[model samples]
Target: MGTLWYGGKVRTLVNEHDIQEAVFVESGIIIDVGSKELLTSKYSKVISNEVNLNGAVLYPGFVDSHLHMIGHGEKLLRLDLSDISSLVDLRETLIQHNRKLGQGEWLIGEGFNENLFNEMIPDKFFLDEILSEQPIVLTRVCRHALVTNSEGLRLAGIDESTLNPPGGVIVKEKGVPTGYLLDKAQDLVKGILPKIDRKYIKRALVTSLDDLYQHGFVGAHTEDLNYYRDPIGTLHTFYEVIDGESRKFRANLLVHHEVAEYIMQDQIEHDYVEKGSIKIFADGALGGRTALLSKPYTDAPSTNGLAIYSPEQLSQIVQKARKFNMPVAIHVIGDLALEYAIQAIEEHPVPSGKRDRLIHLQVTREDLIDRLKKLSVVLDIQPRFVASDFPWVEERLGEERLPYSFAWKRLLNAGLMCSGGSDAPIEPIDPILGIHAAVTRRKPENVGHPGYNSDEKLTLFEAIKLFTLGSAEAISNENKYGLIKAGYTADFTVLSEDLFELAPDEWLNVKVEKTVVDNTVMYERNKD
Candidate 1:
């Protein structure tokens, strides 16, 4: 936990400052970020361990604003159908996965972005008949929708007469259900599945942390712990695993409003952890056409997206959280949901002293930008979506909606505090690839390699700030995390090459040379 160095071009994303040339570390914190000569003359002992980055780039390790612990672990253990296009491929992958599991055992899979599929929503009836013995639940790329084959649905007592949840819809065609569940409808069938135990969950969390480190993330906010058992216990588990091991984590955890309330009211106590913001859901995602759009879906006529909470209910929740001096972060994806969130927040009128966090601020009107600037709303966004979906965004939302979607460029110009996260399990959580997408606004996966609304792309410096400093500000940790100055945690990511000099396409292959957390090497690339 002392004396660290690398020869990379040091990037100090300091406030009101330019990038620094050199960096020095000691005692798990940045000692100095000035020229090399000054640092060398000061800390001369055991200088041989100086990492010869050889002109690579050093930047603040990613601070993923929104992430899940167990959900990401599901990616490693589940069937990864993200790249599988046709129904044939899906069946093939399932059949192959079934081979690895027992005949009657349950199989969980993740990452099937229907938007990227050629057939979009496939016939789940076929998938049900193919793997009837095992109950397989593969989530869509967007958390807003899920498809449960007939067998999985039938087991949960969902049939033709099954009514949809107030905030969700069970997509049924003819008298029978189509194995598709949108939004809260996912819980209908999911409730029937057996829960993972603490031991397995512990393993999953550890594995996910390892994956995040590989992507150059040193610390993160545990976003989905809101749904886990003893969300506080989840944080301690994460800290305990990281503490004893070489790979450590610096984390800010978001808990459900009820949980935060319990803690703040002195009803609960956990000395092992620190408090996190309150995470709440506003509406569904745009991919499933459930984003609570102001207008009806362009593709699916006659229906607007669903809202999870009415205005008054959301208002009360915000007001209550403010009384406890807790930051409340809400997820709003569609323009309508976005507007609804703003109105409720304004009506609730929390005193101006608390953090205002808006998760995924995906669809923004120009006026919303001004509102955010005035309200000081911290926007937690996903740039990978820009890279992956920009080519098809216009097709999905039409040219009109395209202008306001993923408005990173406009948000920055308006001087709104914005943070970047990959929304893993939904998007690849690689910070480098995420940065590339943020800058280029192009997804190589798409056929056209189109830059969707190119003017919305952010500059290199600005984008890096989102994954680092901007994220820190969201949780009110900017003074300690976002800077490389003395007393800041010596958390940094070293890439194989200088990112500023690389072509956009080269991002896909760029490897993590090292990831340091708490002034120690957490992840070092294999030297094969």
Candidate 2:
């Protein structure tokens, strides 16, 4: 039987003030939407069920344009270090976590940001002083680098004699390995570590789905290929997530070029999964100084970051994806990396309809906005990054690059499509946090610090659309989801309060009252 939902404020978000009070759903599709009296009088006979919203505010479910689902899932079960502000805090946390680990078991932790620490970077020796008996690997918040203890390095066979791998760096000091591996070099230790089981990978995927649902996410464009080295194993984990009975969300899997080939050859498909999307790494992250930049980092003048792949190499990958009518999403953080990505796309043109993406345009030239508009490349941005990186970003990029970095509003004004994401596990998976960051362009609690660029702030409606319509466009599903119009999918996020009515700071405190997909309530705040 079809359902009729009414009795609350419904915002289609086509404009700042487009509101309705009722929506009719049949076969999991919105067939009509309007005022309660209008819809009820129009389709009274067809409706068999009803949901009273009780004054809640309804919006289209959020779509996270870029994130690593498997990693986000796995991190949920790992030692969390995302909030440590000092070395003493880190040491104490690790010492306590180590006590729980069995003898000889590796103690792996993630989400550490060295920028927040009194000491910029923690070396291998720092970890060795606390948990030296067993192996230890602490990943930076960026996930582009990691610091390991001597025992962990020994297990990976890294030493003074080991040369850095292509596209990766082994930070060394006085001809000795410093226990920090950047970018590709992370494989040195990751390859040797005991692999996670397929069962756990599946469990992690399920856990991430539940968590995202609580945050009002119904769909996401996620990359999980690197989580498991075995391509088949990674695919199996994804299949389990989508095909399992508990599955309630949709995911567009952005496969690495390596895994994309396998899936293409095998023709893998699922009801809740969309394939033919390829993911590429143009460079590393800015915080790690691995994101390729045109000029050297102001703080470190000796090196100008690293380019993971040559322009020619990226072009070749793009060409391959084009053959399959797939979209290619490149991770570009610096101007240099963005330039290389543009060059590759130019040399190897994709089909006219496919929308390739430029992820993390944190530092880019304003002049390139026109080129991006012409190429029809969507900008997949993380709004939370502005809140997390500001003030600190000044130290890394300096004043010269400030105008062009995180220029989301500029790009949008220039007629380029920009979608929003959390880059979850890197930031938080909460869509409200992303929205607050986008609208306020400042930290929630810090009112004194000037925004990185206040002029780049988006309006509340503009920010919400980035997670709805803009994200749907990025995934090539704009007409199917992202709106409350008739014929759109019946997926909605019901909030405790009207977002537009709240103060800027109050948006951060907003909670999800319910999450509905296909006219079924997937998450209820009270039950959770």
Candidate 3:
């Protein structure tokens, strides 16, 4: 028996203007797509169910090419400081939240951007005044830096005497620890946080997936093995959530390099979950001034940036992954980091069918783009970054580098494939918001403002392709997923309005009507 879906505008994505009236799905695979009359007549005998879209618009299911699944769930569970605009507000919020915590529990908060604060940076003195007796750790929005109280420093055995780890920093003033940790130094305190059990891991994965379904995401290529610190149990938890429970969501897991060998030894591909690539971090983030760059930051000239791995070290890691027939997905935010990543890939190339991914090519040059075009690689970009980091980012890179910073359209025009992501928990997880950022290239609030580098804006159709076809291609699943035509997986996202007709701003108000995966309705808007 098959399900027939009709009375909707279906964007096949085969071309810009290919719209079909109906689609038929059987056994979780699309069987046919054509005019309503033709599909209804052809599958009439075997049709067991019929779905009436009622003037909605349907497109290929959305997929996020990069995100931390468990981190998203943790953000939901922990105290969120993303909205605290000032230090006074943060102190008050933490004071209120501290009252609800159990004895000896660390007061953990995430997503604080000092850029919005009148007090340019956070210090331990302010936290000590609020709750000097207890330990607290507040992570920056970028997740590359954090500020903790004196108690937290004591618990982690970090002080002025402690030397900074390789590729990490402990911010200090006058030989005194200021409770700020950058890059890998964040692990010092995070490693000692109360260990989470399998129960917590399962809960986080389930919570994140449910949230994704509601947001119209059919699947995500996520990285989470490093956070949970239990490779086998975490992998099993993913299996239990997606396959055992029949959640009907697809997941392409990218195992971190630290745990790659363990995962590769026992990797199994199921209907809903599959291991994809080896995840590596070549450098830190721009916000933390840790992203390796060819030139010293224009704003801060003390140093260039932090490189997580040297050129030789990065090459060795890529070669190790290649030995197992696995592709490498390295995070590279600065041009220097991108150069290291490109050199490593050129030194140890993956198989022909597989593709290495360079995540967050935020700062790039024309020469690097030319070099990238010659390789078999995918650029996993977070479009929403433009909305969050704009005019302020200009100050960091200076005027000369503005042309290549966050150049999404330029990369596509250069004939390089780019997959879109929100980098959720850092940015919002909504795919519509991501598409809007790509199309408008500005924050929603800045209505009349001609976006920062308006020339880099993507067309509406091209932005949508980043979440659909481009994401599927990143995981090498384009053949069976990310399309509305026959022989594709029966995954669809139904929206209340036709995005093509509405402007990018209107997309923010559009509702997700239905999210279907494997011919099963996973989420539906409540009419009531």
Candidate 4:
């Protein structure tokens, strides 16, 4: 017997058609979709269950194309400093959190951004005053940088004698280490932190998945390779959940470039898992002024930015990924980094059908967008970044580069498949917020700017496709996911209000009333 679901406007997202009637599901698959009258005439007798959508709007289940699942889960367990705006509050929060820690345990926290702080850049002085007994490490909101106290530096063996690594920096003052680590340099201190138990990891993953489900996400294309102490163990935990308890949740994992070789050698394979999309950091982030740029930063002219890998090195890495039948999702925020990535990908072409991805694309020129289109690469973009990094971005790139930055519509017009994501933990995981940002190109708060790039704003339909079809293409799951039609997986995101009735400004107000995955009600608001 199958399940008969009705009572909503079901947007199929295929050919822009919608069904006002019913959808029949059986064995985790959408068997049919039509009107209530016809579905009742056909499947009423055989249906075993029914769902009342309560006149809500139904959309194809949303897919977050880029996120760090384990990292988000870990953040849930750590001290969140995202809202800390002053030194006093930061100090108090850390002191309070420190008091709860067991003796000798390292105090770790993330999501502290100096941009939001009253004082621009932070030093370890204040942290040292509050957290002297136990080592404390606080990662900046960007995740590319971190600040540590004296004890953390001592435990990590970092001192004035410690030289900066090739692609990272150990910020120092007056020839002495300031306990701030940037990019790869963070590994030095993080290496000394105790590993999380495997059981806790499983719990974190579950908690994270449940949170995502509540946000209307059916699945996510996440990179969890280095987010945990045991990357393989984390992967195994994901498989255990998928194969055992949480079969409704779908996750497409990307192997970190550092571990692609090991995965390829081990020949690890699972029904829910696909192999060989290595994540490479071509450059750092724009907030830190470390995203490689074609020209020097307008605000900071001392350096263009940091390039994690040379063009040749990137080409060689792509070649290795090609050998392993893996695609590369290179993080390229600045124009220079994008150019290097494009050149490397061009030099070492993957097989004809394989799709490599360019993550971020925070800063780009018309030429780079054209080149990316020609190369058939996927654009994995975070729409929320436009709303979050505006006005501030103007300072980073100046008026000269502003026109070409965050040009999602231009990429779409140029025939590029752009997958949407929240970059969660960095931003909120809500898809409505992401959709709102993409459609309005404005901040949800409606405070600073009306629109960052009014011309680049996507239509509501187009933006939804980015989270659905575009995300499906990013994970190479086009055939199975991204639509709510017959012969498709029975996954849907039910909204509390009709999205079509709402204006662009009201998109953020729409809530996920219910989320169904694989014909099962994974999450339903107000239902236990």
Candidate achieving the largest lDDT: 3
- By summed lDDT, the worst window of 10 consecutive residues in model 1 runs over 265-274
TM value for model 4: 0.96
Cα displacement (angstroms), candidate 1, residue 83, comes to 1.0
**Model 1 deviation from native, Cα RMSD in Å:** 2.9
Regions of model 1 farther than 4 Å from truth: 1-6, 15-21, 43-54, 228-232, 258-273, 349-353, 445-450, 526-528
Tens digits of per-residue lDDT for model 4 on 221-285? Answer: 88886766777777888887767245577788788888776656655677555553789999999
lDDT of 1 by residue, 26-125 (tens): 6666877776777777677735447666767777877888777567877776677778777778778877888888657776677787566657585467
Q: Which stretches of candidate 4 lie over 4 Å from their true place?
A: 15-19, 244-246, 266-269, 447-449
Better of 1 and 4 by TM-score: 4
TM-scores, one per candidate: 0.92, 0.98, 0.98, 0.96
Number of backbone-clashing residue pairs for each candidate, in the order shown: 0, 0, 0, 0
lDDT of 3 by residue, 1-528 (tens): 999999889988988899999999999899999998998888889999999999998899999999988889888878988878898899899989999999878899999998777476777888889888789999999999999999999999999899999879999999899999999999999998889999988888788888898899999999988787789889888888887345888888998998988888874768888898999999988888898889999999887889999999999999999888899999999999999999999999878898889999999999899989988899999999999888788878898888999999999999999999989899989999999999999999899989888999999989999999999889777898888999999999999888988888889999999999998888899741
Residue 310 CA error for candidate 2 (Å)? 1.2
Q: In model 3, state the lDDT of residue 210.
A: 83
> What's model 2's overall lDDT?
0.87
Query: Under the 3 Å rule for N, CA and C atoms, how many clashes does model 1 have?
Result: 0
Best-to-worst lDDT order: 3, 2, 4, 1
